[model samples]
Target: MDAGCVTAAHRVSCHTMNADLFKPTPERGPHQSSGTAKNARNKPEQSKPELAQVVTDSRTGRSYSKGKLLGKGGFARCYEMTDLSSNKMYAVKVIPQSRVSKPHQREKITNEIELHRTLAHKHVVKFSHYFEDQENIYIFLELCSRKSLAHIWKARHTLTEPEVRYYLRQIISGLKYLHNRGILHRDLKLGNFFINENMDLRLGDFGLAAKLETVEQRKKTICGTPNYLAPEVLNRQGHGTESDVWSLGCVMYTLMCGSPPFETLDLKETYKCIKEVRYNLPSSLSPAAQKLISGILQKNPSDRLTLDQILNHEFFKGFTPDKLPPSSCVMVPELHPPSPAKKFFSKMAKSLFGKKKSKVEKIPCEEKEDRDISKLVSGIVKCSINRQISYKTVGPSEVTSPTGQLVSSVPLEPTPAEEESRKSISRSFKGTMASGTEPCEDVLTPAAVAETAMKVLKDCLTAMPAANRNPPCLSRPQSFLWVTKWVDYSNKYGFGYQLSNQNIGVLFNEGTHLSLCDQRQTVHYCLTNNKHFTFAANSLPEQLRSQKQIVELMANYMEQNLMEGGDLHCEEQASALPPLLLQWVKTDHALVMLFNNGTLQVNFYTDHTKIIVCKSSDDSYLLTYISRERVSYTYLLSMLKEMGCTSELRHRLGYVVQLLQHHTDA
Candidate 1:
């Protein structure tokens, strides 16, 4: 195999050089004669198979008709061939198995063939046919008119935001299909990505793909571009489908920002950067784009966003390349490099005389109010800390600095102001901490304790457990005062809320913001004094997110149970409220109504002879009678006003009103 061939096989060492490899003729050097120079300049690039003269059609075993080569690798040569049989041009890849002596080479080729054979997706490169001739094996594929994404990246310098969205979506769609079928394209990089004539993407070369039924079954073999490899892969640890997601994220950064995130001339330095998980988002990209990238680049595979999540991102909304601005006028960060997008190559320099002086310094700490308060209360408590350094042999060693001396020190006492701050921190961190331990730490300094406490508070606020947290439902709980007073005067209530309705210009708006399946989707609801109310459809419960559907479903089910021969009670305002259980009402949808204790409920017109039970303690559950036909936003708003709803209810209704305004204006 040629040294230039980038093989995806896990065991195929890219480090080996084949002795039989062909090198560019020396006569074409820059100092050569004018004729030689012209020939050298015109000499076809090794990667461009379309420029190579056809020797023979390996598939037919007959003298080849005229066509050009499109791509080439070590053991194989691919040409854009005009099939004499059907007069159609197709890409034919020719590889001689005997010439490929690299370990796992056959396995790589077989994997590619098998993966292509079983998978059928619009965005993936299609395998049309395969067979062997006397001298080589031939695998025919669909012809791609445009160059590799690498070539496009070089030519355009950097892709615009819209172009990034347009291409990434096509690739992710193909990947989603592959993942759904239990396959992982272990090697996903810009070089293997093809752009078709229609400006659509075609994922190419599945040589390193694996069939993964379980997370443990995923690959641990290291085979990917150094710049794009995930941290887990570089550390020689096992990796899964999430590794591809990380690589794809690198590809996305390249497309949108014009360079792989972790890039430097120093190989070890680059590796260290990746290992430490360092990447910066330029201000040129939108916050949403940064957030999506951050989610994809999460270090823990379990936390990374899947391909489907990328498709649903708001960043790709209305993306199209036909609308791209001129190349010279393209907006990009000033830090982006000049292109022919250079590969990550080694340029280590040997110092002739001596090493340069080091200027590294310790990271300085800045003192701020919230930070100080947090540190004072939270700093070293609950955190694993050893006061003294010990030079022990085999048993155990105490924490120490490089100087090898005991480093025990007395913890400072907090100032009166910081002590007051500690009181609040104790309340915040107490919930999630193991039972029985207080925030008491003897050694922490006043400022340090305050800062630590703030940190603990921040962690608590960010990682609140679902059961203990009051989740933001599709809408805020209708004010208890508003509901009680309104329900007393009216026997019949009627109103409808549209799903994701966001066009009106109203003061009240209600909805749920949830993170599900590593993606974010919103659900909405509109409640009014008229007992008539409508909820937006339900959505799936995603990780670390509030699902309105689950809330509504639990509410409705409980309401039905109460109406059915179940118990019911409207306890005193201060009494313990009923526990809310969120049920799955529908995919991408859910219902919310009153549920007393464990019983369920269903709300409907009484003409059908079905009893309706209402539970007052279940604030989590609210009843809504959905109209058979989707209700318009304007009518819903008018109903709310007619019901003489309070200002608080009106505030929750603002979101629906905004939706109405958006549509009417549109």
Candidate 2:
């Protein structure tokens, strides 16, 4: 086998790599174009077999006739293709295996597919299926004939408030769906924001997407264009869904003012402006648009307006998200460097410097609460002081500065804040600290223990375990008052409450701002009211956020234990989508698709389900391929059964039984 070609047998050896290999190290020069397949790659369709080139999917045996090149990007070149059997059209993204042979790159591709698979809304781009061959991976997606919003933005330097509102509503809807599903679109820019022929803005190019499996989860990767990055992201402070809100504010500003609020000639100045949270609200804009943008452009992610609030703003007086029609798309003039629809590859995060053609300059996004220049500088100082600088030993000798002056082995005296941080960590894990019997000098090398100690301190700060950990469910036996009433259960095992449905919403809404996943998905019920309530989330962190499904799960769990039956049957929700039978649900680990399932309760990305698409007018459906993990059919069957099934679903279930029985009749 070739040195670069990955074999399944050597998979483990492939991932244990040098730590530095994962750093955002920019490729020094022009990228090497590696796809050499004469038929699958660059050759024009006219020169290929017959009138058009034909590509067959090995997994499903479906065939697509390649048409024209739609655009090109860092990892893949997209083309317009026609499904021969259905005569349907799509944009196929072709990525060579060599491009994703490495573990991290492969992980990225898998995540992108997973995220795209779970997201389903009128405003989000629809992902169909992914087909792979030995040399390349082909991703099938909805064909948006209008190219992207960047084209429109470039053509019309600034849009009228009405036009901005038109696009804003659609964008927000898609974002709301993503946030509800515990996913974040880290990268948001006009270039990656696409629109279909129906003038509907569909968010796409989720190469920087991530999942928030639990409520306490937060992401640290500094992805997204420098210009569109939230302040917390730049500060290397943990970030969540609110970061996307900040980016949306920047995009909203560009829609009204021709460019991002703080557009500088280069990234440094933009970053500086963002750190200070400096920007001017255009007086010429409508009061509603100005007020909304200003609110969204707030320095603190906590202060930003929620998507629901934005939707209800005075600016959208006559416009409602559901009422928005699919009008013919308005194609604007194209921007510089040709196609503005540049998507991400694992290497995109490294495209900030030197010679890559894609190394174009970036703009800055709206940011956190008002940051004093001193505070910004101090934050940098704090980051530098705490960072773990890797050290290697040549000999057990005294450390020295570059000037050859010897350095002290002991830790420096702590400042008041540092002392506080140490005290807090000490309290959290008092039993783990050493007693006075220990030696005066610490035995661990500074380099050897620096990384580990910092991780502990970080975990202490969040009051949450490390990312990979599934900490035991909250078990505090403490009690608290609910308004004026006395709830007997003060300390609960999980995050459950004892209050009325109305009161529950009132209390949950207070200080519980919308946030990224912060805890495991569990249902908490109020014994007093005998009802479960869900809180609407917002772009603002700590605003009310609760899931109705959680209560449903709790209800099911209780009923399941009561009966002698093995599993509890799903009780249909009065407000849920009109359920339909899953024409087919793939049991394999690679993909899961349910056809003709009516509108979903929510767009969710989890082990239980990653909604590919709701029932379609064409009656066709799509799904995502699980690469890193595989789920069993029995588990899938039980999960769906617990969630409840429509008559049609049972109909299909009977079809399967009959199909099995028919074999015996023959």
Candidate 3:
């Protein structure tokens, strides 16, 4: 959106999947190396992929058992693998040596590893470790199973001005981290950014990252995704960090307009439009947002606003990073997490984009890939849960994807007022910090301050007497705040994510304890019974009371497993329910049910879906919720979804109910 927008800072929490890179349409077979000779490449010629359940990492010497395929793109395929030692599941980017055959390609990977290893920031994806076997290089990454900005924008159309700032503030913070370390991401796109369960926007896919010895040393590499590429890169001019600023402009525009400004079927046509600085600046954007976009999209690299200047812009008046979740805590998720289906959020992210699961292209037949996955449940929920890109027009610019897919684009007439608009918003601040440079009053934004304060508190808490300490419980990292948003929309109690282990939401917040709102923000799910939670008791017919039982068990299980820690594979958790009543679910947690009478129904949670046994008060016999003869699995799932519960949650409950209905309880 070439129009105006504002800035605001908020906390986020979540995980991610892919890196932003061009998907090369390689015609070669899996065993072939296209660019480099098979014999001379770094890979061992005869060392084929072995059919083994476990593979040892050449770097850490740790072995990870392979799980399901997460996604495949560009040069590699990512897999869900369990660290045999820790039993902690991670996403492993398995890049065949066939893909890294070229010297330059190999160096890029090396540079990526080095750059990722040296950096640590909340907005950037955390790299755990990496190693190479004879056939492939395994890059172990923090598994982020959330929507990318691209996925969200495609569904919702565009973000509101406040939401724009909400995402952009973190993007800037992440870039600032990389810039400070003298690393040039080189490639920045909607696909490269992800919102974790925390709601924080993360800058990921550093495969094309570059390292500069100093800020002044410019690199003349003409590499980047076509749409987001800066003009300087196309012209073969030596470029530095300023190039990233241009891509950021594209990102901001896309967020506002719901489409990239310069996409076309032909790359040359796209480049031409960008070079000419043509765009239909939407009138819908606030003056501040328009100014921000126009200021950064300058054709000349030197003419764009610096990161510091952008942060200080009037658009960011209410921006506070403290509201955003810390990235460090969002990393290292628990094992065998829930699937991130095409979850969307327009008018409740509208309809879920049910993308077909394309199989991971290459798997050894003798060695099988784990197909055991939880039910795929996604799509944003209300308060009408929902969800936007970029620039220059070429004859009422028509939208197009990389593969020549034609889509609608917003076209604007090339008006003189728009030209003047562009000219009016020229860079307000230029160049690097110098001897007489103006000191930014906002150099330490609220988020930075809060982060620092939290660190100090952490250190102090470490030294405190165990019995005397009560550290504050924070909320989970979230971007869209879906669960909270649902609570607000559905007027129900919220559950799912927690800011931290100790900080689970308290359920009695709705009306019963309106005073709780006075204490802190209202969360959808609250601790109705300490670890137990219930809906806000909104008294609405749509409230999923059964969901409370499901979530409580889920929460209890998550907490217990968390306390146990390391190498605790979720599958190893013994099912408390019997096999006759067990159910397989795709959610991060399993839903089990029990009954003593119509009134005191008990629900249980398991790591995976399985028939679990219920322990009685006297510790003697198995129990069932016998109050009502049979609760139809189909009816329950329908009501759960009708109440705005996620598909993952609803499906888990269905599995156990199905078992109870069909098996005829003994």
The 10 consecutive residues of candidate 2 with the worst lDDT sum are: 1-10
* Top candidate (lDDT): 3
- Tens-digit lDDT string for candidate 2 (60-100): 66776555566665667677766644546788887777778
TM-score for each candidate, following the candidate numbering: 0.40, 0.41, 0.45
> Local error of candidate 2 at 163, Å?
1.4
lDDT values, one for every candidate: 0.43, 0.45, 0.45
| lDDT per residue as tens, model 3, 91-142 | 7778888768899879878877887877788888878988887778988877
List residue ranges in candidate 3 displaced over 4 A.
1-54, 58-61, 213-217, 318-666
Candidate 3 is scored at a TM of 0.45
lDDT of 2 at 587: 18
Instruction: List, in order, the clash count of every candidate structure.
Output: 81, 20, 84
Candidate 2 ranges beyond 4 A from true positions: 1-52, 213-217, 318-666
Residue 269's lDDT within candidate 1 is 81
State in Å the error of residue 5, model 3. Answer: 50
The alpha-carbon lDDT assigned to residue 409 of candidate 3 equals 27
